[model samples]
Target: MTSDTVPVPPGGEILRYAAFTTRPDGGNPAGVVLDASGLSTERMLAIAAEVGYSETAFLIPGRAEGTYTVRYFSPLLEVPFCGHATVASAVALAERAGPGHYVFATPAGEVPIEVDKDADGVLRATLTSVEPHVEEAGEADVAEALALLGWSPEDLDAALPPRIAYGGARHLVLAAATRDRLARLAYDFDGLAAYMTARDLVTLQLVWRESEDVFHVRDPFPVGGVVEDPATGAAAAAFGAYLRELGAVTVPATLTLHQGDDLGRPGLLHVELREGDARVRVSGAAVAIP
Candidate 1:
């Protein structure tokens, strides 16, 4: 059904939360429909589009308590998974149900989420990603992506090669040689969106490594019908896997990601990798937008 024909349920409230930051204006904002049992796919899409956030999450209660079947939709289409929205939804649930563990059954796979209050009395959520993998990006595809972004091969960081990374969703991981290069992010939206659509990529994880464990990043999400994602938790999870697979980071280590600074909505993402597990864990704080 077209967005114009989609129906809004009576008194259906959409909770707004900013994921990855305690402040409402900081992290990536996501719409959480706590009970979307009656909503159709088209209805969910229309709601997300109306919300105008990068993504929104709809939750349907599972047979067991503390377990939910979740769906994520960008303004344009449904995505396999969305980390920020998961964080937002988990925290939202915690506020109503009390903090603890919750499992989300997403299109990609099952994700376990843990919610707890920190020392500062702020609620934080950590999500264990589905099994992740990294694959080599075809040289031709990389060149095309770079061309669309107006980036030259020389602007790339040779240390961190281009690759396709997946934690819950897929992202093209590209590293910039300098912080300056990463900061300048004007790209051909239409062309890049087409490229990403052809490859089934969710976003381009453009990054600049500051230290072994700290990095600054950005994500261009034209295919999702957003100019950019201020803070991308899914991409951060994918990046954690990328670092482990590339042997760029020590196992059982925690890494820090700084994002959305350029957009004036700075946020932080904590990524953890355990020695025995291939799955990545992404943690962030979320606050309700009043």
Candidate 2:
């Protein structure tokens, strides 16, 4: 069935916790509904509101063993898919059921997730998204976005032209030319949020590349009722797709994304692009929140 037409369960029954990086206070946070067998849209929305984060993930056991269906939500509303929350939920399940592969059936489409322990025993998860797409932003949209962000066209990096990218959800990717330019982040929340909402955007993926394979990134999630995201996996995955489209990177590549430093909640995201597979792979460690 098409995700657009897929029905949300009546209401979920369990609540679990997942810490995308380390303890609860660090990294990105997400709510995990371990077994959402029968959940309604309104019920899931309420649960997400109570948990209160940029995104929360709900899991349902799938047809096969070791597989599951997953859904993601923000405090404000339901999103098609979420990467950080997916990592969080997978790790949480691994800790309990042991590390393995799980399938997520999201509003956007089917996502494949796998969890395992690293050499240091850090629980990390890798999620492969549905096929990704990128599009150019209209001049008017870019102007409005820049005005809200308090940035002019001069602040942009010509190397990375502005565009809208999609992996799980849609993000407006804007590249900053200088580190200083990316650091000084100030925006009109209301204005930007309204603009994003009208365009069905989840966040503004603001970025600055430090080297060939490393980047510094930030996400303005005004539409999710947050000024900024501490860590963003979904956007990172979308960015990988964007890079491939720009011919900036080749397939079967691994890229590093650093974010949340300005807010003091630093996070690291690893992304992979496989040859012959258009899906983006986002990997990160997740720990329990005490």
Candidate 3:
């Protein structure tokens, strides 16, 4: 049956958690429905809007233990996969069952998440992405995107160029020549939303390289009905793939992404690409939003 035709159960209780940080005020907040067995598609969208986060996760019991079927919804639409919400939901489950491994059957694919406590006594979850791929973005498309973002072609980093990258979802990757260029992000909401909608893009992964392994990034998520996403796990995963594809980073490398600082909600994302592995791994800590 088609996704739209699938039956949705009734609504369940919703919990709130912030992913990628230890402090409740930090990281990206997401709504988590631990038992969404009864939620319908329409109802889920309503719940997501009510939660008012970038995205919310709904979990249904899976066939096996430590497994669950998951769905992600933004305020306005259902997404194929949501990284922050996935991390948040896994930690929520881990808190109840103790830190361990959990399998989430997302619309994108089977994602395996491992939750464990670090030395700092923080609960962190690492998610293995599905097979990732990158494609060269058309020059015309890049021009249009730059216009919508109020960015000039000269502001773009020629070394990184522009590309469309995908892990669980697609993102348009744009590298800025300088941190200053990336920081002054003022965009036309309607124009960008239209462009992104036409391309089925989740966000624009605007970034600037800080050092060999450190980078500053931001995501413009007009498609998700959010002005900006403080911490974007999906984009980070896709960026890992983008770097690997472009040979920008050596394999078996780990990178640190700092985001949401400009928005005053600082977040950190750890991305790792293992040797001989095609899928990227993203890890971060989460906290319950009280």
Candidate 3 has a TM-score of 0.96
In candidate 1, what are the lDDT values of residues 69-112, reduced to their tens digit? 99999999999999999999999999999999999999999999
**Most lDDT-accurate candidate:** 1
Poorest 10 consecutive residues by lDDT, candidate 1 = 1-10
**Least lDDT summed over 10 consecutive residues: which range in candidate 2?**
1-10
TM-score of every model versus the real structure: 0.97, 0.92, 0.96
Go through the candidates in order and give each one's C-alpha lDDT: 0.94, 0.84, 0.92
Predict model 1's lDDT versus the native.
0.94
Which candidate's TM-score is highest?
1
* Candidate 2 residue lDDT tens string, 1-290: 12233333334233444444655566787777787777777767777777677787877787888677777878787888888888888887788888888887888888888888888888889989888999999999999999999999999999999999999899999999999999999999998889999999999999999998899999999888888988888899899999999988867789999888888877888989988888899998887665
On TM-score, the stronger of 1 and 2 is 1
Ranking by TM-score: 1, 3, 2
lDDT of 2 at 290: 53
Model 1, 202: alpha-carbon shift in Å? 0.4
- Using lDDT as the measure, what is the rank order of every candidate, best first? 1, 3, 2
Can you write out model 3's per-residue Cα lDDT over 1-290, one digit (the tens) per residue? 12343333344357889999888999899999888886778878877887789999999978888999999999999999999999999999999999999999999999999999988778999999989999989999999999999999999998998999999999999999999998899999989999999999999999999998899999999988999999999999999999999999988899999998998889999999999998999999999999
